[model samples]
Target: MNTSTPSRHRRATRHIRAVIQILSTAMLGILLLLNITPLLAYAQSETDVTELGVVKLANALEEGKITSVEAVQEYLDRIKAYDKKIGDKPGLNAIVTLNQHALEEAAELDKERASGHIRGPLHGIPVLVKDNINTADMPTSQGNQALATYQPKQDATAVQRLKYAGAIVLGKTNMAEFAMFWDTVSSVNGRTYNPYDPTKNINGSSGGTGAAIAASLAAIGLGTESCGSITDVSSFTNLVGFRPTVGLGSMAGVDYNPLGDAIGPLALSVEDAAMLLDVLAGTDPKDPWTSEADSHKSDSYLASLKGSTLKGARIGYVIAPFGGYDYSPGPESDGIFSTTEDAISVLEAQGATVVKIPLNRSWWNKYAPQNASFWATTGHENFFVRTEATWPKGLAELTEPKDAINFGDIVKGSPKMEKTAVEWVMGDDKQPRDEAGFTAAVNARHTFAQGVDELFTSYKLDALAYPTVAAPPAKVHENPGELLDSEQFGTHCGWANFTGRPVVSVPVGFADHFPVGLSMLGSQFGDVKLLGFAYNLEQAAPHRKTPELTPSLLHTAGSTGTTASSDPSTGSDEASSGNAPFTSSSGMSPSAVALSLAAVLAAAIVLISLFVRRRKK
Candidate 1:
């Protein structure tokens, strides 16, 4: 009876199989459409840009994975996506201006590549410069309205070197007005927001460059730091900011708030920062301060990035620099207590041995007043004229820390203004300092550097680790008040500037969900080694993470009544699951699929055995 019904069974089975094939193909088509659309979009989206250093880019170029024009276009598209204004709305606004000639320059680079000529690591890399640095091509506005339209006649020494190294200038970045304060704001340009969280400030005169690099807007960018300008900004924005020992690079054409300032590089990765620093570091006759620096320039910094360099590195931790200072009774000398322990904790946990060391804050307080007196006493008359009377008609009152764009205007009026900005802090008629504050600060700087140097000698330290500040970045409004009055964290950063030490700031982690920086200060001219050490520590700790701007999906997973249990042996437990059998949010039972697969295989095996027995009979 079974043999006679075989033909009928085969006909019914064929009809069912045809239905299944039709449904399966339809489902496959829908799945393919769903997958292909996003992939195509991802390929088309300009956001696929890699935020790599120049060295990495060069490697990719040589490997034929990326074209020079494509790399430049990726960065330009990112800048266009993140830097423009839609309306009364807001975005990152990290870039102050985009290089108009970037495409043309990139075309030239591609042409050079076609001719079998490679400039170097930076041959096709795109970089951004702080607005204070003269690019000659882009307008150099020092984040002030006065210089919004001012353009330099030539590149800064730093910029010239970058171009010679084959790097492309992507644009000019915004900064604090005249690089005057820790908080970043500019009358000429709006504020720069943190890339991880747009609601938060990026932190500083170099904030724009930090945010840009963090968001993958450029390969690298130049940032000038007078005090905590670079470090604090780097910390909050999760980027590498290097403040090279003063005069390690020429600052002749770089705009300055006052006379003395250090221009450096900021990048997404420490390697990229090293690449830029290597190319730009050297002496220049135009800048007198360059003579004071140690002539230990290297052809490339990447050659020295040995991860094993930190194996036995001793890291000094500064709990408080102004903890016990008793000199000035002003607000600038006030103490700030922190909710979290200093950033040294993060550094210590990451493997480097950390030692707590207290600094004499009193010496710095005394030095501050003495230094102010010296500035006032030496230039009182000139300061009064600049502040009390306007030099040119229609010009605003000349003040200390004038805009770099209007610097020329001030210079045109009087030679003194050309030499120094008109600041009332120092006047020729002021009373002489009871104590030599400037000398004391200078001496204290040497003392601080020496104390750490000796500590390094004693411990065979690679670098000293310290908190960029006692706390996370202060509010933008609070920056001015703290700078003018008292800030406990001021000396934490200023000491590096005082000693002309190479300090690299890495985003240690978040305190209260806000970014915090741990700085690595190395011996004089130890920039490359210090950067390598910081990079390794960063890899070990991995403190920085993208901010959660919206409600986490895990919260939604927890709200559901289902409780998925994790397999303890595999460490696969759902963090939100209670210890019980849990239903999946996706309506599929996990055990059902396994049972169905077993049944299908069993049926096939039984049919095959029957067929074999029939043949044998």
Candidate 2:
């Protein structure tokens, strides 16, 4: 963690520049303007079972058409055929550990259906989960070596709910290391690329789950967020990611959660996300906090999935909040934001009134810094640090422990985990604060929380909406120097986390070939209403397009013809988007440390040369 090693690799910067030039020319927005059919048209063109989500598949299965195993197998085959093609270049590595017993479990479900015992809504559906959630049948490694073989004695409460609903656990998805970073670079599993562009970041720490659902690796996946981990990455990966109100879903059996991290659903369709949320939302005696949950804890969340649910809702938009960090808003980010802005327009068209709101930067700056401390004290501690202090000697080496964790870094070797250690103590370097800073930050967080409460009360608003990120996905290893522009967006989206309010990130549009998300921020515990608005907007925008893995015109053509055309972008999808435009005025200006030093050296060189010439004379 040398804080001063040039923002990125020199080679990565060159590649990013080249890709940006190509993308700027062949932007997705241009294609949308030309009236090219969206990627979703593929489902309309064919009766592909893969195109159908869990609920539809369940109906088909119940009607004696498609067997449960058949549906699960189709998703597995999809993972095999299109995993790498859609841009997660190495193909889709969405799945970390495939349940060897998936086929067997599906067989059992089919038999149960034959026995006339229908489980429920998620019955017979194959669902993927973020690695941090525990499952009795499989190892739940929170993407760490330390718990490589760790297997929970029981399924996490959420997983249990899925099982009760008759969903088959397909596998454990990949994630960021200990869910520490937003990039899916795990010490154990390498990286999880964006399903749309493998070369770019899928958006972590819940990236694998987002990519899995977007790519249809599984009908739905569960992703957890401490801050923007779920919502931000889901926005980038073109999926629906929900962060429920605190203590809504039972955290029992989840590997992490010293902080109040809530696990929610990521899916291709918002309805599917809602279904999963319904199954998972309930009071659990094991978690004392659940006792304080809103009285609506037991409400049927799925009942709010009506298409007309958004009518008459009041929505606020944050247009300028995140624009500050975007140096090069990729085609995906740009397209998605425009699409979302247009979506808000459409919502207005559909009778929902929209209002513009200027964000409070002072409030954001005050409380936002505590997110690292919150995450570290909560989820990070329960999952990793606590394990170190409690686990038996050589726990990972025990008899085929289900979770595929590699703990050598934590236990056996005194590895140079100083970087990881530092993160545990502080947070990400880009946003760091000290003890006093954190204390002041905690107070600031309360003030900001109060502001949000006031906004909710004053406006009596249903929800606030904004683009998930300043730009779309960037290639992995892109020069970090360029991402300064959209930092404010990250800051803005992140404020909700500090406030402990529920936020839903739905894929509404694409920008610069990357996926941009529209977020719905609601009154505390207004998860259902936020989701309702999203569902309505989703229909209006209906722009979910599958990325064409290969560079083919047909891919860019109507979905029925071929995959989408490939957009030129360099680096990994998980890396930072190329250099964001720097603003000279406004905000904490980032001094160009490297460039400034280079200038200083050049001046000294000229002075020395002049002195040398004088001496020679």
Candidate 3:
């Protein structure tokens, strides 16, 4: 009698289990669909390729969605639209000379890609190098009209490396005349204005690259630094400027002082900068300073760009370097200090332990000024000798210049050179030309480096953070020399140059409508770690903003037959290759998103199957 009742109960239980299984499977399917919608939307979104980093660009190139020629042309179109004067609005005079064969070169790279011979991450990417860094195709003007026609017979070591890695040399960017001034005013290219604000100056001598990069004139740029040149210009222009350890990259084709000169990247993002560095860093026979680069260089700087790089890292904040109301109290200084504090908080939130580490102000005061003077003199001497030795005879034969043949000649030819020459001559007179004073300055720098090392060792720090330039950029009309009167000018950045350490300047926030930069200084040969740390900070709080005046071109893919609108007020047409595999603003590539969706679907299927089986039991 109980058997019949049990049979009926068993059948009822089986029916209930079947219903539950069906509901669970349906719910799982709905959840999977909901989860993948955003991913699909991201994959289909229209993203401007001009805003892409090196990795994305490379992936696009590999995927055959876009050709190198198209990318190069897009950059060229952007330059044409906004680089020069447009109507009454002052243009960003960032580029000195356009590469005459850029398109042809890009076509060749496209051919290479088609042949399945990929060079590296930089393959087919366009790059802008500062005028001082020699390129075989363009003149190494050093921003002096005197050398406007002086092309080098061979590429600079860094340039050669970039090219070997399949990067196209887009052009040379303008810089201070002979890289002599902080403001990027030149005898050849005139001046470079800030992309963020036309009325403001793009601090130099890397200002040209900074402005160009900020405005998306090129994919990325190469900038050389002596003292605050790289950091200053990058900070003011809201870019990521990396000045690697002096010996990290070759200075063969660059006209820089051996003591403090470095060539690094100015990019829209930290990862791109790191990619550039990965290609640039290594020993070069022409650059004796890089004799140890092979040993010091990382296998891949880009590999270190993890978002968790800041986790468990110790970062020391040096307040003296960031001059604010505490030292030179004022509205501007207060604003800078406030911005810096906010930046430190962001770092702390990103898992970094921030601690205030007071630098030896007396040590900085005693040597920073003298070191600046010393490097300026020695750097000029090196520049003069190097230029005269390496000047391209063919180009010199073709075009005769009115200005002097060398720095010495330039000093006699132009009044602009007078002040700098006097400084050089007086510096030599005071220190006997790289002898007593030079040695003293070097020792002072070594001491400073030791102090920094000790601080890091004691705290087990990953990096030292500060405002790249103590104060905001001086106005366009403000003389850099005059700005030095504020006591904060160059104080924070000069020490990095003097000590030959790696420092990266990244946009922190805004101050009075202008961009403010936070600098991260690392030990010698610590370029990768420094870049990683900066990348982490950048990913956490992306402070870099695209300038309103130089908005992203609507035709960033160059597939559109029509060019970008010349009028700044009107945006360009939707990107020409909108149908091409998309990359989201968050930098997730279409392929990556697809893969993620596939994985999620698989996991969901497994969960649904498990639920269905359990209910059926």
Give the top-scoring candidate (TM-score). 3
TM-score of each: 0.67, 0.71, 0.75
Compose the digit string of candidate 3's lDDT tens values, residues 342-381.
Answer: 8898889978899897545564564343333444344344
Candidate 1: where is the Cα deviation over 4 Å? 1-47, 85-89, 257-260, 292-294, 321-351, 360-461, 476-491, 544-617
Task: Evaluate candidate 3 by giving its C-alpha RMSD to the native, one decimal.
Answer: 17.9
Q: For candidate 1, report its TM-score.
A: 0.67
Q: Which candidate is the best by lDDT?
A: 3
| Stretches of candidate 2 exceeding 4 Å from the true structure | 1-47, 82-89, 292-294, 320-337, 360-444, 478-491, 550-617
lDDT of 2 by residue, 403-517 (tens): 4222333433223223553345234222222455546545655666776776667777788777776554546765311221123234245546667788887766555556777
User: Could you tell which candidate, 1 or 2, scores higher by lDDT?
Assistant: 2
Clashing pairs in 3: none
lDDT of 1 by residue, 50-98 (tens): 4455667777767767766777766764454456542234556778888
Q: Residue 195 error for model 3, in Å?
A: 0.9
- Assess candidate 1 and give its lDDT: 0.60
Q: How many residue pairs clash in each candidate?
A: 11, 61, 0
What is the lDDT for 176 in model 1? 72
